[model samples]
Target: MREYEYHAPLSLERLFELAEAEGMEVRFLAGGTDLMPRISAERNQIPRDRKPPMRIIYLGGLGLDEVTDDGESVTIGATASLSALLDNGAVRTKLPALHEALREMAGVSVRNTATIGGNIMNASPAADSVPPLLVLGAECLLRSAAGERRVALSEFFTGPGKTVARPGELLVSVTVKPGRGGSAFRKLGRRKAETLSVVNAAACVELRDGLCESVRIAVGSAAPVVVRCTGAEQALVGKKIDENSVREAGALVVKALSPIDDIRSSAWYRARVAPTMVARALLAAAERKRG
Candidate 1:
């Protein structure tokens, strides 16, 4: 990477001042999992006008690394590592879908270094944690020198490798409210571990008196950004989640996708496998012990 001045600001205020001074040219170093390699590879290739910053602000001392659950919602700080999330008892018990996603993410070493904020800010179409977050009705907390605002995880991403975070803003935390039912996450990759997903799915469903009370489903690598299968969710709501209903909902998920051919898999393959993945997620969610 280009030689850059490193600033380790001890407080959020100092970090914001640096950001304000540098404007769009300042880059935040969270876990450095995504930033380091990308900057190294693209340093000499990108055009000058579009080049990323050479000023780095390390977030190690900013006290943003935390995980807190108040029984209603779980708030994960920006610098909280994926491995840390996996170790939290509350995360495992209340957010099974998220737990599953974290477990299926890049192996132990990578998880130990990758931060949740980095994963969200990277805005990858196949980001492992995002689908489960979406199903749990997660919201992102963004802060700047000016103030703070909350954006739903569904609305945080604008496109692949893009987000709505402003020039001076930083992602502070992600808050996920507990869903009213069982949840599950499933992903298909070239291998069992340490591989990017070809297709990933998450589902949360509430059953009442043998019928679906509410449901939320999300799929990744099927669109430009992780997307909620609202059509399928609507179809399943209030309906008995039987074999036919599950199959029909899965078909609806496929219909909602906008897949494209890429190095990992063909558009046809993604489209074909999407329904089964959705069905599997639903079945897994349905099987989760009802609270």
Candidate 2:
């Protein structure tokens, strides 16, 4: 990395103060998994020109580093690591689908270093957290010298590795509502672990009075962003979970995807499987009612 000053503020306010003065020149450092690799590459590319100070705002010390319940919903601190959530009971009880997604994310070692906030902030098109969290209807908390804003997780992502986070603002936490439903997450990657997801998804549904009371389905890597299938969901929102409704809903899901042909997989293949994934997830949710 190039030469520059480094400051590790013990508090968020101080971090904001430093950030207000530096702007883009200041990159908040959390876990440093993505930034460190980029920094290393930048240094190698420019041996002559002095690189910018790997000016990092250490998120490790930030007080927002745990998962907690607030009666109605769960708040995940920005610095909460994946490994930490692997064993959190409340999380497992309320949202095992997310835990299932995490367990299969990357590998154990990478999970140890990857933070929930970083994954959301990075907004990778193939990020495992995005699809499940989208299905869970999560929101993000951002803080900066100007103030704090609560943005829906769906709105937080702008594109690949991009977000609405402004200068001096750092992601503080994520909030998810408490829910009782069956949810499932699946990913298609080049390898079993530590691989990019070619496509991934999460489905959640609840039945009341033998009719689907609510349903949320989200798919990723099949579009520019993780998208909830409002149309498909509408098909199941009030109907009983039956073979015909599910078959039709699955078709709706197929219409929702907009995958692209790439080295990992083809758009046609992704389109074909998207509905199958959604149907399976819905079936999983419906089976819970019988048990």
Candidate 3:
């Protein structure tokens, strides 16, 4: 990596001051799992149009690594490691879809070093955490020198690797409201472990008197951003969780998808399998509710 100045600010005030400093290109360092790799690749560039030197502000000292459950919702601090969330009772018991996604993400070692905020900020369409978080109604808390604001996770991503967060703003935490229903997550990849998703799906369903009371479905790697399948969700509500209803809901999900051909899979293949994945997620969630 190129030479750069590093700052470890003990307070958010110091961090914001460093971020807002005039004329310096600044980046926040959380887990560094993603940032470090990108930084190391800069050395291989031709150097004719190299980017400016980066000023990294380490976020570890700012005490933004806590995970707390306040009965109504669970708030995960931006710097909280993925492994930390997996061990939290609220995450495991109250948010099963997110819990399952975290379990299947990368591997144990990488999870230990990857932060929840980093995963959200990276904003990959195939990111495993996003689909489940979207279905669970997660929100992000962004902070700056001016103040703080909350953005719904569904509305946060504008495109791949992009978000609406203003300049000089830091992602402070992600808060998710737990649902009374059951939820599930499913992923398809080249291999079972340590692989990026080709397509992933998540669903949360509430059942009442053998009928679907409500449902939320989200699919990743099927569009530019992880998206909720509201069409499918609407179709499933008030219907019995049976073969025909599940199949119809699955088919409706394709209307919301606009997948592209990529290194891992083809657009046709994703479209073909996406419906099955969505159906499976819904089936699993419904079974969980019944159990």
lDDT score, candidate 1, position 78: 88
Which stretches of candidate 2 lie above 4 Å from their native place? 1-4, 22-24, 47-54, 242-244
TM-score of each: 0.94, 0.91, 0.97
Q: lDDT by residue for model 3 over 1-291, one digit each (tens)?
A: 345779999999888988985656788899988898987777666566646677899999998999899899999999999899999898999988999999989999999999999999988999999999998899999999999999999999999999998778999999999768889999998899888999999999999998999999999998999999999999988999877898998899999999999899999999989999999999988988998
Predictions ranked by lDDT, top down? 3, 1, 2
Instruction: Judge candidate 2 at residue 69 and give its lDDT.
Output: 92
Writing each residue's lDDT as its tens digit, candidate 2 over 1-291 gives: 356557888887788777865323777777777677877777668477654454667877767888889778989998888988887886787776688789888898888888888888877787888888888889999988778899998888887778898867889999988577767787778899988887887888888888899999998888877888989999888898877887899899877778999888899898988887777767776775545
Better of 1 and 3 by TM-score: 3
Kindly state the number of residue pairs that clash in model 3: 0
What's model 3's TM-score? 0.97
Which whole-number lDDT from 0 to 100 does residue 95 have in model 3?
89
Model 1, residue 84: what's the lDDT? Answer: 94
- Model 1: lDDT equals 0.89
Candidate 1 lDDT by residue in tens digits, 1-291 = 345668999988888888875324688898898899977777657555544447788987888989998889889998999999999898999999999999999899999989999999899999999999999999999999999999999899999999999987999999999857889999999898899999999999989997899999999998999999999999998888777898999989987799999999999999999888889989889888444
Return the lDDT, model 1, position 148.
96
> Ten residues in a row with the worst lDDT in model 1?
44-53
Q: Which stretches of candidate 1 lie over 4 Å from their true place?
A: 1-3, 22-24, 43-53
Better of 2 and 3 by lDDT: 3
Ordered from best to worst TM-score, the candidate numbers read: 3, 1, 2
Name the best candidate (by TM-score).
3
